[model samples]
Target: MFGIGTYPRGGRLFVAALAVACCGFGNTGTADADTFIPLPGGIITRELADGTTITIRIDEESAKVSPSLGSTPVHRNVWVSGVGSVDLAGPSADTATIKISPGYVVGCQMDISSLGVNENAGESNTLSQTAPYITPSLSESFGGGITLAPGQAVARLMLDLEKPDDYGMESHKRYNKVPGPHASVTWVDEAFEVNGCGGYAQARSFVLAEIDTTTFIGNLALWGQPFTMG
Candidate 1:
């Protein structure tokens, strides 16, 4: 599993930890299916379902590592998830049905972008309509949106984690931890549609990961015997 593991001090596991992390990407400049592209700490080199090749890597100088919030250590490992993904097929809704690609997405952070064909951020086109349906089980309140009115004009979903300092906060001990690892959001074979004019628009899905596990568990490391200096 690409799942992150903990570091061990002065043991074989310590060497092993570094070994896995050194897998070093971009050798072939691609990844097989279901592979994780580490965020600022890791990189993704692959083509999306749309055949657009992208690379995701955090510059060593820009990587931020700190003790994660709500951790016992409270002094180290503030590192978090990496961010990047392929642009699974997008659809433009037109009073019928909409489609999202590369089914069964799982991640802590996802980007959903929907807007008026002629509009930029915070601005809507005349008579454009989009009603985004987020999985009720997940929090859809991560981003700001205009309140729903009778046949509202537009809906937009955005998740931009490329900026490490701007990463979203997920309370470690609050929810989705232990005996279970669940995504903050999941879009499995979903379709959307618009009800008004302005021509329904395209949707893109990107993924981001957290370095800390959602679980409160660790492996038992065996130190055997303490080394003595002669």
Candidate 2:
């Protein structure tokens, strides 16, 4: 999934994010002695040394977040797209429990461009392509930077998802991006199956969302984490 915007361009830009899942991602929103913990798995509990239990969501499969942790785990039953959920704190103390369910497979969305590009009428530069990766894959360089001129622009944005090989090596590329500049365009790739050969495929999805910028004067920001499948 990607969201695009335009502004004066100068330097190259890129953005990335990991899939959101089990106690996946969270922020305290403050710097005081607090931790921003994400609970996406629908049911999560942090046991204190003194036996005080802190319970919360597992975060990967749902978007419905409570303002704060509730007392009854059942009340935290939030809704999610594509994933069936489990009950909270059901009668077990030592049994680490998990259940299987059906859900959509989300891929990585890279938006590395931000604030449009500003060309110097006669100057041309190449827009570089970021590398693609498989699960636990590293980033790469694919598209060369685009050349630009004053008052003229190019859509240097592209999102690619390649399926891994039979042995789990990636072998396909699914790229989505508007070829040119438009006001604001959002391209969301449909959910696809993950490379299942990896042991963690049933529980994790690696995602990267980046901002591509010509100049680094301003900041490009991305919110949210990877979509959890467990």
Candidate 3:
């Protein structure tokens, strides 16, 4: 349940967070104001257990908030990509094991590409399929966007969980404040696995992202929520 609308006000959020941490531009940046927010990308398809066809696609999630020296505002870093594919609708070809249930990637090295998949690449979100979720479902990859259909595409994964951490809002005593791109890539459990036929199958899907810190600092914003299970 995520399909709101409003991410283009005039000039794509008005970048000002010290040029998004340009390289060293942050001695407490923030001259006056110009919040920048833009988030929208989603898609999730499911049908695994032998007749594989599990597709998940997230184009680009976003976030930016600059101006930090003490007041509170500096969570710049954004660039996310997704594309999970599997289609063995019976008859022949098989062998599938897509895994990326991993939390968040803030730098690099979360890549996977398969032209003729025989995969085992970058595996580590640790969730091993356990099927059993026809009701207690929940979706919120920020809260909107998912459309991927056409034989269910194939493998592709990219990450840029930008890093800036240190957004002082102090909700209470946790301090995480949704920093570090947070983390939420679900498949209920197992995320992926399909080898020969059947006997044990369970691989649903779900994603949730956040980064819209706008209370008054530089205006930065980006809410490309994501969530889906089928």
Candidate 4:
């Protein structure tokens, strides 16, 4: 399957919902494979797995990549599990924030809730806010926001639909079928502080929302409904 889906002003609508579900899975290339490519100002086109392709040119300068249709125009060094096809060749760009370190995925149906972390904007206010894996120093870094120090680094979280849904709070409700469909992931923090360098880092991030199944319970994965929409 696939993962990483959540939107509400977090990088190109979560990379256009992972580029409209990126062709519904085919290249199960595995080996840390993750995909999302939607470029043209609100930039986002990442394929990270060592092939090299980056253009998260969010604020400006230095953003390049190759091979979407190919004709010889390779532009390397974008590092970190690199994968390509994202452009923002200037002209007052809009968005382009990229980073795929430890992992990435959004979903392609295993009955939705493909992966998760925290925050649908509820659950005691998402565990009392303030915890995006810490990272933000030098007087709160300010440009593209991320200033790593206290160990691990991996940030790409989006998903918060209004509030009052539960799970991770607010949106994670899907159910369909038998013997399968119930996924989860959570690791908000074992320790905090980024800029001042604290220690113990573990902030899991994955939320491919869309699981309603009449509110709660367990085992869910139903499809082809003549009626039902939550």
Query: lDDT for every model?
Result: 0.20, 0.25, 0.21, 0.21
lDDT of 3 by residue, 1-230 (tens): 11212211111111111000011111222122322333343444333233323233444333232222342322122223332221112311122222222122111111111111112212111222211111112111211122122222211112213344378443221111122211223221111211221111111112321112221111111112421110
Instruction: Summarize candidate 4's per-residue lDDT along 132-220 as a digit string, tens digits.
Output: 32222112221222334433343332222144544656642121111111222222111111222122212121212221122221111
lDDT of 4 at 203: 19
Predicted structure 3, TM vs. truth: 0.23
Model 3, backbone clash pairs (residues 3+ apart or across chains), number: 23
Q: List the residue pairs that clash in candidate 1.
A: 38-42, 39-82, 66-77, 66-78, 67-76, 67-78, 68-77, 81-209, 81-210, 112-157
For model 2, the superposed segments whose C-alpha errors exceed 4 Å read 1-127, 131-183, 202-223
lDDT of 2 by residue, 153-174 (tens): 2222234446666899866443
lDDT of candidate model 4 versus the reference: 0.21
| Per-residue lDDT value at 156 in model 1 | 28
RMSD of every prediction:
24.0, 22.5, 22.4, 20.0
Q: Would you give me the overall lDDT of model 2?
A: 0.25
Q: How close is candidate 2 to the true structure, as a TM-score?
A: 0.24
